[model samples]
Target: MPTLYLLKTFSDSTFSLDVLIGEDDMTEHVDVVVAGGGPVGLMLAVELRLAGVAVTVLERRTDIDPTIKAGSLNSPTIQALYRRGMLPELEAARDENMRQFAAFAAQRSGGGGPAIPRFAGHFGGVMLDRDTIDQDDPVLVEQAHLGTLGLVSQQQFESMLERRARDLGVDVRRGVTLTGFHDTGDGVTVDTDSGTVTAGWLVGCDGGRSLVRKQAGFDFPGTAPEITAYQAMATLRGTEALEVGWHVTDTGVYAYGPHPGRILVAEFDGAPRDRTEPVTPAELQAAVRRVTGVDVGVDAITSATRFTDNARQATEYRKGRVLLAGDAAHVHSPFGGQGLNLGVGDAVNLGWKLAATVRGWAPDGLLDTYTAERHPVGEWVLDWTRAQIAIMRPDPHARAIRAVVADLASRGDGATYLATRISGVWQRYDLPGEHPLVGRSAPDLAFADGSRLADHLHDGRALLVDLRDDAGLRRSADGYADRLTVLTATADDTDLRALLVRPDGYVAWAATDAADTGPDKYLGLWLGAPVGD
Candidate 1:
């Protein structure tokens, strides 16, 4: 086994580590080492720390990326932030972003138009209605009944998560790049530009071209790019006659947005751009002309980026003590801003399970469930992006299909289904249970005392919520009381008398008041044995 270094000072607080006593062999040791300090990495760090495990984040970049890659956070992500007690700051950021977007919309509409409600998340340029999507919105969210989505820039989101991780006492090392690593069966020895560190587990949240994934020999396989997409903010040399929204034409599909100079284009030329080359004004002008057939001159290219329908995913999320998350685990098009949501979901799913393993109370096969649960979700997202790209092709047949989808999305049922899918509320894990909500994300139920179910999850721990004073249920769950919090309350809204909510905010077991088993069986399945059993 590779030798681990002695304990090092982690934050300005009392802490301890079971590190191998060595000085020159290793510089530091932690419970977990998270690579790439994006929102996914920072979120994982927070989750591990919330479970009382020591974690360190090794971020290559010293500061946040400037590009506004992901425009907003979807329903599942917002609900997760709420569960972590991080909604207030992000909600304020969302409100500010909406104000800016509304102002831009007014300018485009020439003023006096109705203000846009802050929750219309679009998929393939189709606006998902907030009213239909979030009818059963997560309770206690800042958006309330409007929706569970939040409009915050990727930069803002990552910055906020970094701050929260620091507050949770995570040691974040900036400007440190991981050069290599060795998973020595028991722990991981990670080599970085600064020095060598040892940890019980290592997770790579690095971007799509993940060095960790490459070095660890994880097989990433998927379809090639069928279309090249571009989004640019440049000075357009034209008047305000351009109508905003997708314009499907005989040649290709192009779109104009609320911002005056912001535009996007898609070409079915089957030619992918060299991603290494930065997008230029000439290239942007050429792409726009090819798709819209409009020779709109570009005076300057302020910000520009290119993506493709290239989708790929790792065969497995974990290999021994080394694992992957976020872009390192999967890569897909930014068709509907699903990349960030998918990556954050991966972190949330892996965080608690990994912590359980590191803390030494893990149920057998608990770690394997991460792959079993998230791999299918990742595949679903890949297919989602493929469908969008297929419908956006410039051919006559594609336009006909697009029209049909547009009609369906305009209807109530179709809108609800699509919105639910896009928001990730449709994604319920295959947990063991017969209850309708057994495998689904738990709805934030409100109690008669004005307390909400989401309020109890602030500490990132599992909750066994008993709607009534049931000592039998409490006794059954008391064995694992150290890791589970049993909250007894009254809910007048639903008939659900009991729910076993996991740390990641998913329902493991749910039952109506009439069920005789109470919350007994699923407790051991998820939280392991009771304390004194």
Candidate 2:
């Protein structure tokens, strides 16, 4: 017997349990085997354990990637981190960047004028301001982080999530690769770089070219590359003539930097360069010259990488017992830095459903919703990227359309819509409910004591909040015990008498008229087997 640990701390508490690992005809077995121990895979592991399932995460690299491939984390992602209690330290480090942006916005707007996107985001090359966005006050972040589009290097963000996942006792195996997997229908036998392990499910959190997706024969079809995009960080001098924002040149589109040390160069080269090979300093310098028509001096190139709008997606998120998440399921242009945010969103949405399936309480077709919900969202993101690429084309039609959008983006409503879409604020599911908040992210409703709704969901269980403290509703929740948590609070607002919230902080049900329609209806629909089953 091996002592398997559960995520006891940072949630309810950290603890370990005894379980059989090696059994007859096998090396070890877990309820879930996750390939590619990046942000998404690790997040899924934590979600599974929160539901009391054993999970093992296998990653290809021995260490975190040094490349800062992603540079932005959006609002939804910030909320996810806050839910997991991993936001404070990262927020602490983000102070300087926030201050810099704040100062820049003040200077640009003559010191606090009309609202903008709080942080600078872009569509194509056009800037989208957060202050201009028409949204409720942010519910997911602290007061200091409100309305501010904050930036954290990919390295810092991934390291934090990885640490948080490990603290939850997830078995994250590094330097391990998944060579193959067989979905025997009942379960999956996965062969990895280390050895073979069997599990009830297998998920590939690997990158775009996913072995699991390839071996499982998931159909991935989409547009090819429009252009090769290059991002570089280097030591440079004597290039002040280079513009600080996106530029559509006669030749191609290029952006110099908000950071004086960095530069972005895009060439309308039909095919993207081979990213497998390391980007050379000479290559980066040459790219700079080609885009800017400037023989800029480069002291040294710290990092260089290339990407394309070669978007593709899996026709299905899962095949039999094999599933996919993150880049394995979809790949897109890195425009607006949605790649990481989208992958993290996938992990959060799929986590609880998959865990329920493994724990044997998943209602019929519960796991299937993973694809149903994410695939469309993935499609939307791909089109969003494609739309950006459309306007960046160096042609009369593209230039004219770009001009019209730029003008429209200045309108309050237009900017708000763009900001909301870019921040993923409008993302809502069509669940079985009529309540307006049912399919949307639950408002961080404040209690009379100032404690917000998320305070009760750290345990990753469904929450039944009774503002009126009605005995019937209270008893209704008590039936589910650990699966359903009941909270008694005088609401910070009096709009609703009570509500039910899922672990992901979405409202499952709510009652505004003080009528207790029996919490069992919604509870069973979501958590299975109602109370006192």
Candidate 3:
């Protein structure tokens, strides 16, 4: 039997663990333990550290890969990254031609209209050329030319994130794979390849195959057997322009795009195929040639891996002292490039909440809101990606529907809707009540003080912008100065008081009404508190 070590915090928080070193045994205790050191995990660690929480990250991989897997970032994700001060570096390192555009192709469907669909507006997808439009983006043009999308490889992103985490006083240990975890009612004892460690709280930031989620006995409910996907990074010998093109042929569905000096091609199969069955360079070259009718020599092959698009979302993100974020919470197809973006968004959403929980200022139910808020978004992404994959299938019904949708997509409203869906701006968290602004992200509003609603969130604190006319309420709010910021604006003032903003930039409790709903109720709910509590 392994010797069990018990650790206690100053606040009476205690953790117990059985330490084991192969056949021998030793144990150590910690405050919070995070599994995985990928981008999502590292981002969570950094966010927690910034919030003054102590965390330790365990990573199995020794290095990151240089090849870009996720090709582009949407505007909402750009804003989230900007909040973390990572936008500058990412923008600087992204491929230059990162402007969004739609592509239209014509094909004949047996049912009707043009066989090829016409797509317009931003729904078409952004072209990240990595050569031209990189410097013009306002966020990240100044950092050393890393690679478009900010850092060149997964390893480099991890390296930079590790440096940032260290700057914020986080303990990151690499080459440590989690083997097993035990929840001893008080805390969790995590058994890793390196050693056994105990912590008051544990977060699973590991990828789709999350060991932490499994250890917690949380069920990932959804479709199983996993849909497979094939991805490869290959250099196109004679292409300088980077553009994403969609080609629909009777034989199959194929898409190609310029990536750095190479081009990436994706083929969807109705059935699973062995990823390591051995693929020749000539085979890939031939596929590209078949799709584009352009013979671009394959100078080099970076990586070819097979992955599944498992549409499974963890039944719950939080289970006792352990929590899950990013891919650990949800897994879906890579259609519309939603996986990485959604994962990063999850990190941003959970980061502040975790920090508040650690700091002891968080309300009782605030932490639980992570699952309440993100689970639906994850489910939505999975459904949408599945639809996208279905669209690429060679079935007659799918083909006909694609044709109809493509034709409908040519219109302004259809194009706008598609753009919103692809850009991820259409997502909104569920808020109670029938208020017009509730559940919708508050639009940026200009104020007389030269401040924007988003600007107030820089300190990572909840904000209460009083748009009501009662001067006495503002005076009374001064009593709770430390917990909330009171900004006064006249009802007639179109500039500042036009909207009441929530911390996450959503209009949680907003009104143009001069009538007082009582600041306490509004503020309490936005602060994740129940009325009169």
Candidate 4:
């Protein structure tokens, strides 16, 4: 066992502590060491810290990446943050980003047409008409108020998460990269460019090209890329006739400004020879011209990156003590902005379970459930992006399929289907329960005391929400009171009689009457049996 030494420091009225792994060994120790400081890693750090777990985040970049990525947060991610009491901050960030975009548009277009049309999202350049959506759809009605998407840049979201992580005393070390790690039977010994760290566990959130994932020897198998795509912000000439939204041309597809000089073009011509090569203005200009058949001149460019439809996922998320999350666990096309949302979901789902394991109260195979629940979701995302790529292919059969898909998406039912999937309100884990609400995200029900369900979940503990105030139900949950919060409140909107919510906000069990079976069985399955029982 590694010996831990404690050191305390106080500065700026904020408190933080440092743990050293003995002077003789000169190794640092933490409950968890997360590679990558992006939104996924930071969110996981915040979640773990809320459970009082010591976490250290290793990031190679000293500052947030400013490149344009994942422009919106889906429903699940927004609700996850809302449950953690960060909804207000997220909304503020969205509003600020909107304001900045409006200012940029005004300065660039000199107050022309609307910056961008209102829409839920798109599939293969086919827009999901927001106006055609069925507001009363069963899967979506409960979350209608939160809207389909939260418009915030990846940079803004990461900044917010980083701030929360710091405020919660997470050791976010920038300018440090994970060189390698070894998971001994007891714990993981992580080697970084800076130094070695002994941690209870290590998670790789280090994007698609994850060094941790590669070093851990996880098998990553999937399809090869068929198209090369380019996204850039540049100074351009012409484009007088280019449309503002997505367009599927004969050669490929291209989407012009919602932001000035910001464009994305995809060509069916095979993947780039070298994706690592920095995209030049002329290169992007040529691609744009080929896709749109417009003589657009790219004078200057900034923030350009190459991508493909390559999709791959780890056969297993965890191998011994080293695990993977976010892009490190799965890689797919970035269409429909699902990457960030998928990663955020992974963090929320894993944080509590991993924390439980580290704290020594996790039920048998509790940590194993992380991959079981999230791998399917990741697989779904990969297939979803692959479907989009299929529809966007520049072939006669693909165009025919695209037309049918577009028509379907133009109707109420199809729009609702796309909207639910895009917003992630349709996500449900396959937990063991027969009730309709079981294994689904707990509805944000409003209580008689003016508190919503999310308000009670801010502390990152399992919640036992009792609508009927049954004494038997209360007694049944008494054993796990230390790790559970019981809220007795009347909710008018939901027909649910009672709900046992996991720390990740998924319903573990539901009861229609006080006479029904007690929650002890399900609670034990998830939170483990009562100590000394």
Candidate that scores best on TM-score = 4
Whole-model lDDT per candidate? 0.81, 0.77, 0.62, 0.87
Model 3 lDDT tens row, 137-207: 32233222223342233444556677888776677887778898988877898898777888878899898
Per-prediction TM-score to the true structure, in the order listed: 0.91, 0.89, 0.76, 0.94
Rank the candidate models, highest lDDT first.
Answer: 4, 1, 2, 3
Lowest lDDT 10-mer window, candidate 3?
100-109
Question: What's the TM for model 4?
Answer: 0.94
Candidate 1 lDDT over 257-323, as tens digits, reads 6555778888777646487788888898988877777778888887788877779999999988888
> On TM-score, who's better, 2 or 4?
4
Selected candidate, larger TM-score, 2 vs 3: 2
Total residue pair clashes for candidate 2: 15
In model 1, state the lDDT of residue 87. 70
**Model 2: per-residue lDDT, tens digit, 186-284?**
999898767788888998898898999999999999998878877887887656466566777866778755544567877777766577898777777
Model 3 Cα shift for residue 448 (angstroms) = 3.8
Which stretches of candidate 3 lie above 4 Å from their native place? 1-28, 94-163, 224-228, 237-244, 266-272, 275-299, 449-451, 466-503, 526-533
TM-score of model 2 (CA atoms): 0.89
Which 10-residue span in candidate 2 carries the lowest summed lDDT?
A: 7-16
* Residue 358 lDDT, candidate 2, scale 0-100: 76
